[model samples]
Target: MEPLGQDEIRASFVNCTRGEAKGVTLPAPPSEIPWDRREFLGWRDPKAPARAYLVLPYGGEVIGLALRAAAPPKSRLRSNICGFCTTTHGLADITLFSARRAGKAGREGNTLGTYACGNLACSQYVRGELKPDVPQPYESLTVEERAGRLEEKLHKFVARVLESR
Candidate 1:
């Protein structure tokens, strides 16, 4: 199947929240992530209505991301290696922030917990080895630019979910 778009993801969020969805699980391709029980690391919560989980698979790289609102404790503090750069920097350099949703994900009025590198150390999508202490290879972009890029990518995926419905 083609990569899920923002719309499809949004619709899934609605169905899940309303209890209309029996089960919605997005599995990582076997080639990227191992086919283990834990491989299904998607979101699941009865209380929250507009949230969804994304299991980004860039090869063996697996980063757990919670797409929900940024109200209070929703902005969590977790430590993990960067999916692109496999550096211990994830502990200090990474900060999970609230992401704005699009389409239905946005319409559902949910927030996204985006785990992003604090600095421009690694490309958000490209696979790389994060060096916490070392300087980044690419020229640094403004926070606005970084956020915009992230939003674009996220919306694309969310849109897929909306269209599926």
Candidate 2:
């Protein structure tokens, strides 16, 4: 994805600081996460960790990002499907990722999270669905091409958010 602009990043920090962060509704886990895993995942407690989150004022929607820090030591199996593409990453391909949480002032903190994709692209939660500048993936594109398309979409969404405010 295109790098978030300075202003956008700053705005994101404001949102995090203000506790305005938002997350998608998720089903309860079958078993409660263990304390060690909870700490590793940045969750203070398994019951209420802020997973499945996306930043807001970015095209008026939050995108799910499985941040790098929150990933498991090894990838694990997933029975759930991708919310974006609506296709399973397959039981084996599925992995968890942590979302980046901006901390107050100079502090950078990891807020615990577990997402299905090791990469944070939540296509189902895309904020640019009706926008003109963003591009959708096509049948013939290479991996790089698809990534570039999504990058453009993310940048455009950020710009739109800034414009609105």
Candidate 3:
């Protein structure tokens, strides 16, 4: 991923009004982000933990989404896997996040959700750079391959958000 500026990030949102996009609270300016270590930029709003955002270069353009994190599930499974990076973690570490669909569908209240890292750190989790809460299952794929899959999954998810409208 390439580095982004504040204006670019704010203007990339496809799922919300320009005013809403302008009101988004970025975790930090793009200059502080480790661009090489991220597949996309994501973070939860400190003032509103349930509110989150993801921005990425997709389909040859930068796009962004406004997401809301669903409450953690009370399932029997001891661990959960992130749909984007396939990284395993304690149930609390995996969260279901929903994004309002772009355009008229969003205006109509349509939304889509996917299980993802609660901290939105799938990029680091997939690379073994972030600590795991549970013993992760071994995989034969190299780090690059895993990273590639993460990108593919992320792109597909973003596509769903865009196409839902």
Candidate 4:
């Protein structure tokens, strides 16, 4: 992923109002980000644990989505998998995050949700920089292959949010 400044991030949001986009926080400047190691920039709102955001390179431009976490699960299942990184995690480490659809659909309260790493650090997880709480099953695929799979899933999720219908 390329480096993205605050202005780009604010402008890239399609599922949020302009005012909400402006309020999204970046813990550090764009230059300070470890861009080479990331496939997308994702983080929760520092002030609002329930709010999160994701920005990634898509087609010719960057796309961003504002996400909200679903209510906490009642049962603590021992294992779960993140849709993006395909890593196994304890139920508590996974979250069901929903993003409002773009355009009129979003305004009408339409949304799509998927389970993912609660911290939104799939990029690091796939690269072995981060590890889930439970042991991950061995995969024959190489790191690059896993990363490609992550990128593909990310793109699909973004496309669903951007879909007009």
Candidate 5:
């Protein structure tokens, strides 16, 4: 993935209004990110724990999506897997995130949810940069294949977010 500037990241959003894009927190500058090791840039908002974001170079352009995380349960933790990267993590490390569909569907309160890394670190997870204590579900896949699968899943999720009513 190529490094992206702040403006490029803000303009790449397809599922939210321009103002919403501007308001959400963005990842660090490209120079600060480990670009070569990342398949996509993702992060959770420091000011809003429930808010998360993901930006990726898809097709010929970058695509961004804003996600809202469900509040954590008050009871015991349970194991979960990220929908995009399919990486397994402890209960506390996984979150259920939802993205409002684009266009009129969003206005009608339509949303799509998936279990994801709580910190939005699927890139690092798939790259083995952040190892899971337990065996990953994709242990059989090569690192490259795991990254490719992550990208493929991300694209599908983004497409769903951009889909019209």
Candidate 6:
């Protein structure tokens, strides 16, 4: 995926209002990101750990989404797998993140949730920069294939969010 500018990132959000897009914090510049190894850029807000964000280059334009982390369970384990990168992680490292539906459904409080890396490091995990304690199902696949699969899942999730209304 190509690097994105702050303006482009802000304009790419389909699941949030314009004011919300302007107010959210963006990840570092493209030069700071390891683009060659990343399928998408994701990060948690420093000021608000509960708030997360994901941005990817989809179709001919960039697509961004705002995510909210769900409350943790009483017990922590290391067996959960991220839906995007398919990497297994400890309970604290995995989060159930939810995205509000786009447009009217979102304004009405509808959201979709999936288990993901708590730190939003799916790109790194898929690239093998961050190793999972448990073996991933895609271990047999080439790194490029794994990354492609991750991107496809992300696109589907985004589509679901936008079409849920």
lDDT of each: 0.41, 0.34, 0.91, 0.91, 0.84, 0.84
TM-score of each: 0.30, 0.30, 0.96, 0.97, 0.91, 0.91
lDDT of 5 by residue, 107-157 (tens): 788999888888888888777788876566536888899899998999898
Regions of candidate 5 where Cα sits further than 4 Å from its true position: 74-77
**Clashing residue pairs for model 5:** none
Clashing pairs in 4: none
Evaluated against the true structure, the overall lDDT of model 2 is: 0.34
Clashes by residue pair, model 3: none
Tens-place lDDT per residue, model 1, 1-165, is: 123333343343432443333344443333553223121234433455344455433223332344543332333544554432233452555545443453466456654445444442334322233245545456466644653554455445444444433
Q: Residues 70-133, candidate 2: write the lDDT tens digits.
A: 4344435435443223234544433454434433411444343333433333332233222222
Candidate 3, residues 32-134: lDDT per residue as tens digits?
Answer: 8999988899999998899999999899999999999999898998888899999988998999999999988999999999999999998898788998879
lDDT for predicted candidate 4 compared with the true structure: 0.91
Q: Candidate 6 on 80-143: residue-level lDDT in tens? A: 8889988888777789999999889999999999999889888888777887665666358888
Q: How many residue pairs clash in all the candidates, one count each?
A: 27, 3, 0, 0, 0, 0
TM-score, candidate 4, is 0.97
Higher-lDDT candidate of 3 and 5: 3
Off by over 4 Å in 2: 1-4, 14-54, 58-68, 72-80, 83-86, 91-93, 99-110, 124-165
- Compare candidates 1 and 6 on lDDT and give the better one: 6
Global CA lDDT computed for model 1? 0.41
